[model samples]
Target: MRSLVEAQISRIKRCIGERLLTQELASQEGEGVIIANLLNRWNAFGKPVCVKNA
Candidate 1:
């Protein structure tokens, strides 16, 4: 999943190479919003943690 997200970000970066795409960037702002909404419906995703305990 991490690789998939990285690939998506890389694709976007390539598409906007040497230029900033405000409109495109705005459009993608909602990319993960839907998933977050669905997760909220299911009461998923607890508070985020920066590091894992070993």
Candidate 2:
């Protein structure tokens, strides 16, 4: 579980980048929300769908 979380954080850093570009706590929080949403969208697209064939 811990590794999964760490991997996610690493992915975000790699895809978006590390460090907040905006100053102030409020903007930083907003940035976090935005990054989270982007990550969700990216993960949704990257997920593999398994189709069963008989």
Candidate 3:
């Protein structure tokens, strides 16, 4: 029973890791669209844009 519980936990961790990886990959691939959408939303909210020096 203990071993079975451990295996289920491991499977859940693996699934969560895979989902996070997919989200990261999708964000990287769609960065331009994401940035544009964010900017549009910011404008709609009347937020001031500030530049930060790296």
Which parts of model 2 are misplaced by more than 4 Å? Answer: 1-11, 48-54
lDDT of each: 0.56, 0.88, 0.58
Rank all candidate structures by their lDDT, best first, as comma-separated numbers.
2, 3, 1
The best candidate in terms of TM-score: 2
What lDDT tens digits, residue by residue, belong to model 3 across residues 4-29?
76875675456434233334767756
Off by over 4 Å in 1: 18-54
Q: TM-score for each prediction?
A: 0.32, 0.61, 0.32
How does residue 29 of candidate 3 score in lDDT? 62
> What is the C-alpha lDDT profile of model 2 across 6-37, one tens digit per residue?
99889778878999899999999999999889
**Which 10 consecutive residues of model 3 have the lowest summed lDDT?**
14-23
Of the two candidates 1 and 2, the one with more favorable TM-score, higher being better, is 2
Mind giving the per-residue lDDT tens digits that candidate 1 earns over 1-54? Answer: 999778756754564353433457665566546544654554465545799789
Q: Model 1, residue 26: what's the lDDT?
A: 62
Candidate 3: stretches off by over 4 Å: 1-29, 47-54
Top candidate when judged by lDDT against the true structure: 2
Collision pairs in model 3: none
